[model samples]
Target chain A: MKKDLNITPLNTLSLVDKVEMRITQYIKDNNLSVGDTIPKELQFAEALGVSRTVIREALSRLRTIGIIDSKKHKGMVLSHPDFIQNFEKVIDTNLLEDETLKDIFELRLILEMGMVDVLFARKTKEDLKELEEIVDRMETNNSESTIFKLENEVAFHGKLYEMSGNKTLQRFQNLLLPVFQYVHEHKLPDAEPYKYSKKFTTHRELLNYLKEDDIKAFKKGLSNHLEPHLDRILEKSKS
Target chain B: MKKDLNITPLNTLSLVDKVEMRITQYIKDNNLSVGDTIPKELQFAEALGVSRTVIREALSRLRTIGIIDSKKHKGMVLSHPDFIQNFEKVIDTNLLEDETLKDIFELRLILEMGMVDVLFARKTKEDLKELEEIVDRMETNNSESTIFKLENEVAFHGKLYEMSGNKTLQRFQNLLLPVFQYVHEHKLPDAEPYKYSKKFTTHRELLNYLKEDDIKAFKKGLSNHLEPHLDRILEKSKS
Candidate 1:
């Protein structure tokens, strides 16, 4: 065998990045929990063998993300990270690329399709009734409008996510649903008319499949329901 | 309708929060993008009728999130906010509750199961061969091991996600996969010896499903493959 010379690439992480990893490590190593106090900056710097300035920058980033609670006597304390709030805070839609937005929008479609089992397992009679009502409104309000009534579209899909009963999935669904709306309003405009324009599945059809508990048919119908989006995104990418 | 009283909740957003929203809105309304300079602090203050201090705090928050490139000429310019970097930076594992962790862990399951179509559609022959090699390693590395070879488990699942060809989903998969590992190592231990011990679908079986191009079977198999994680999470929640 030839000599094994698998040289790795040089470390690309900045000092702050490495220091931040070390500090998060210290917390995990000590099994720290929310409201727990971490060591002062000097102690952390000394422990991690980094400069005080680097530790300070790392700590500051943590505080900015609401990871550190400075309000506890204005000292360093671990706190519950409000991710939903933090995600909302940092999300500047204009700064994101169209590809990033479409990827996120596609994530919603994937999640919706992935969640049919959860939906069927956990749905209640009232859930079905509400879904039907939303679809009824979608049909009533300008059914000839080529696409959809925005509010009803959200309600129909949001209701399905709610029925999934996975709190994590719901949180992600809430965060990502707006990306879909944004894509529909902005990037997906002026598309060639829907490819499956003849046989596109509506919200009501999806609800009926759910009501029958026919998961396979429901899944196929969802793929159809969301086909227009995929078609538009694919066409745009090809162009 | 006796005395229509459909009042909404009071506004809970603080001045800084409102100003941040306004600035983001201004960016969208003006179609400002990367490298574009935002209005100076005083200009924003005058336009929004907010104090310079409020504008300062809002801008500071934006800087912390990397939304505003403060270093470009030492003034504010729109920047591509690096979400993955920011997410990794802010994540403090010790502070997250088991419930939150489980929620995120469940997200991986949903995403993977949802991505069967992508994997099937996009997986190349080389992708399959590499997957087989990884599974072979797992097989050789003490196949009797009840849980998994941690590195191999990550490799197998990560490969599947890579095959999906969704950049957003892959980023999310990368971020959330570690959470899965964390849960597996931390919270999900001491699990009652695995519920599907008798009939669990291993990664090998999932590959076979893909090889046969049976999408529905592969989807069902992925659910079974991930069921152990869910079983444990549900069991803990119930108890």
Candidate 2:
């Protein structure tokens, strides 16, 4: 069944874990793709010099993660991994470490800033209209306040993410939604000078930058919008 | 034993699935945080009117994903969720859909673009020196070529991600390395005009932009550097 790689299991990882890794490596090394038939468990066991039970356990882990499935007659087959799909369950807020939550929050901001060009290239009349309408709705409610409501902010920015047409980014945005909300919930006080600098970019202001098709201004606008959080993240790093 | 939430099991989802959702809901409603003690299985079973077997299965799923753990006499306690840690195993390219892979590649570029300010803020003498050395190493080998070697590219970009000082971004760059490698290996014939306007930004050119600390030009440089892949992602979306 096998005559190549040595199967001396290491002490650091469980045998099952070691087998799972080896199997993935085998698939990659062999250039197998989705729908490719995986060899039988017995073959794997014999090749790796491990028991069939260990092979089964490793296969079970892969199966649980949507990497492989048992075919009706063809035995196990590789399947497409829905890695982003797991974000729903993986993003349990109560369990994330503070630094991880902070890191994710930074990631969300980076994504927002990073997508500026994509949004410009892909924005439709309808897309801009939707974003403008969301901003308009927010402007109506704000008699004098600078910040928009969370729902309105979500609507405007969600539309922008939708405009980028990246499904992964859309789902990733959903995943980071909690981290941003969590940070806002436990928000640190903004630096007085930063706030007094009067550089806050409002919803409509950002929309105008988008409507004008200005990548630099839009990026700058987005940064200004996220300045408080950005400053907080940078401040924590320095300390 | 009685509970507020209605627990009639749904036809669509398994009983275990339903129980998992309800347990998470209970945790949120009760303001639970990390290390909080989880209620006993019997108590949950009685409260939700589900069998202890169903509760156990649901808890096992939670345990595997590391949302909760059993502590001495303290029973099950909440744990920090490591959503980012799973990216390594979850990012198996052998099983990812092409579209998903493309979207992820797009995300990596976006993260690179998005982390500009953070990179600028965090870049140190050591970081810049390392990046410069990588460029120098690449330049010496390039007798005459527009593109740098793949290893050199990885070193340069990996260093940039590190400069952002984002733990999550660093791991994410690792997750995306295969996607980029795969795309380059199976690269599409790039458009004709794109090959010529003379806009391909080289790695050292990007490093020089960074050294200058011109955020605007650096973003433009980064965008030029990624224009090919970005164009490909957008072109596919249109069709």
Candidate 3:
């Protein structure tokens, strides 16, 4: 076995962390916009009393999160970090504990239910058509192969998230999709049996509710559609 | 004005990005858990056919997100990224566009509504007692100073999020708290007048609903509490 390296107790703050905090404060203090150029690395090093290497390391961290971008012509520009991209990197299903995964599962349900008002207000005719087509494809697949691909489920929900007209919320839903799918596929301990009965409302029914602009009916239909997973979580918790 | 540096068109993938992806994949493939020691930097450089500097840069990025922690004796250990900490770094209220901030405002509302089920299910007697005290504090402050500190409002809501028994959800609420506070303090464009009248359900009323395990009443009370902000958003969207 490899021996442990001689470790020192961690300081409450590391030099790199302090440098990162200083850089963030600089951006905020300057009120930098997406395309605004940040000061050069050497300037930051001098101002922060850190070495050029420390500044470079801090910049690399910022770039990793999409908060700052370095171009050949532009040294560093403030940019909106891709929250979804950063989240996707770390959301490996295998890496998460089961409780965390289940929490994500519940979060997805909450998001789907919570976005109904936006969906009713913001959905366009084209969005409806796209959703209808996805539901149609699901129906065809259900009848032909008697199997529904996970992508089909994701596509339908993804379309709804897009129609909600909240990009941040939509991105968050997309970020959680993988964990949602992982739970669905694995049927982890405490997962109830999938409800295959035809009595529950289908995607088409939910679409009809959406098309009618019936928020109540749509919420009802959605709750019915999501009941199996919700029931699984509820049942598991009770047991 | 700073002279533009000689810029090159960004490739779809940067070497650093590739290395980052490879490192993430390595962690997954190795099934590394929190506190598991990562392979040495030189070992990664040799395996990935990159220089040690590239490996160090990539590792720095991971450290920024809390995905890897390095200690003198421990070398590097895999760790769960603290989503809230990273988010706080980039969530500068002044830096965000007004639209994005508004979107966050709506997201907070959604989260609040969605958490009701979990709150009802998981809230303990002690949780109720704590919530009562917060509401009591607010009432006392309102009676004495005729003003509700924003901290009181946040404390009441924060307690509800905690009672939901979802750590991920609670952290998200905490992460978004700053943006929420920003909107509250600034009275952003389209914000409706804050209701000063005693006509609506008070926090104590909401607490009563929670005590009785009345989900419907709780939701109604919460909706009434949030109506001013919700009305503002809805009205703004119409125009």
Candidate 4:
């Protein structure tokens, strides 16, 4: 075939990206599901009119994202992309700008607050018991400190996400944890002192609302629980 | 140096994953920001006690995530990771399960509902003008359809995200779009018809709420707008 010198490669996407898109389109067009086998490199290269090297690069990108797994004998199989794998790859806290970190903290609040309906709709006795244990552990801490360790906070909230029975939402909560931890450890600029007033509801109060299936009260309690952190985010943004 | 028989690899993470993590740690430890040059492959391999090939593999993974860029004469440079690059690599609709798709649709609702406060807080006159144009277009569509086309729907909601002035949240909304499209096109297993009654508020009404800066009313309007889609997800879950 004669080279077409006049034709410019108008594609702004790199060859690897283009190939990746095509592979995804291929999977969709073929109605391929998880565990389904994908074509070999040579076959893909020939089918897509690209070189084997391009195919290999695209497949490597796919494999990195967990979209296609390579087994001992199987060439390549479609797989459910692990949310953590992709999320963790981009979540180097030090690399993220301060504003981005704050945005993530805000996102955490949004997700937790928006989860009220699902949490109430799906809470079970077992879920409630686990949450109660976490709250009780906080209450009985020998240190006599009302402040929660990061793990304690994560356990209580993580339990709530699990009870929501939405794996996708749970994954989002897990992904946001690192940012939350960063913010919690290093308070935002101009962060105000947390008010330890009698009116503030603890996890126990929130749990009571969940137990009673009072979503309205649960939302109010949850908001009260998250108020200190939310205030920091709002204050930081204002300044 | 002689190899010792008693020595075992203590790290459970794959060599590539470990190297990737170490490289990220290196960037953080050195306080490297976007456009900052990182050490060469040979330097990293020596520092991390790994082969150049392994370092290269790890760097490749980082580059795919946009955490690092390999520029001519610049070696590896730290860069901001593009959310879409990593997100697009995994968002194969065919590979996603039906329940996962529904979960994503639900996530869209959560994000939109959560956006109300921000939208009202940050919305500007220019934003209102643009939104009014979109709503006007929707009203004047030749089909005389109160129902929004997918593009129109995206424009209205996308504009709201933009007006919220949170780039991270906007990116998230953009990333969830494919799954939203999938759900909209394929409607859930037990999807119901949208009740387009005279009482149902349109985008125009939502705009009026925004113009009046009535977040409470806007939330109610937004909820009503998303009601049918939310109903489908809730209905599908019941089955």
lDDT of 3 by residue, B4-113 (tens): 76564568677877898899888888877887998999999999999998888888888877788887898998876765566666675255667778889889988887
User: Which stretches in model 1 have alpha-carbon errors above 4 Å?
Assistant: A1-22, A39-58, A72-74, A142-148, A185-198, A232-239, B1-19, B41-57, B72-74, B143-148, B185-198, B234-239
Q: Write the per-residue lDDT of candidate 1 for residues A45-163, one digit (tens) a residue.
A: 88888899888878876776777876546578888776555566545455777778877777787888777766776788898888898888887896556455766778788898898
Listing every candidate in turn, what is its Cα RMSD in Å to the true structure after a full C-alpha superposition?
5.1, 6.4, 5.7, 6.7
lDDT of 3 by residue, A14-35 (tens): 7877898788887877777888
Judge candidate 1 at residue A148 and give its lDDT: 55
> What shift in Å separates residue A236 of candidate 2 from its native position after superposition?
2.4
Give the CAPRI class of candidate 4. Answer: acceptable
Isolated chain A: TM-score per model?
0.80, 0.86, 0.82, 0.81
For every prediction, compared with the true complex, DockQ reads: 0.50, 0.54, 0.42, 0.44
lDDT (10s digit) by residue, model 4, range A119-191? 6666789988889999988777736544455568788889988887888889888888887888777857644
Highest lDDT: give the candidate number. Answer: 2
Task: Mark the regions of model 3 whose C-alpha exceeds 4 Å error after superposition.
Answer: A1-12, A29-37, A71-74, A92-94, A144-147, A190-198, B1-12, B29-39, B71-74, B92-94, B143-147, B184-187, B191-199
Query: What local lDDT score does residue B206 receive in model 3, on the 0 to 100 scale?
Result: 94
TM-score of each: 0.82, 0.84, 0.85, 0.82
Where model 2 places Cα greater than 4 Å from the true spot, the runs are A1-12, A29-32, A36-57, A69-77, A143-148, A191-194, A197-199, B1-12, B36-57, B69-77, B144-148, B191-194, B197-199
Q: What share of the true interface contacts does candidate 3 keep?
A: 0.40
Cα distance off (Å), candidate 3, residue A135: 2.3
Better of 1 and 2 by lDDT: 2
Clashing pairs in 2: A95-B80, A95-B81
Candidate No. with top DockQ? 2
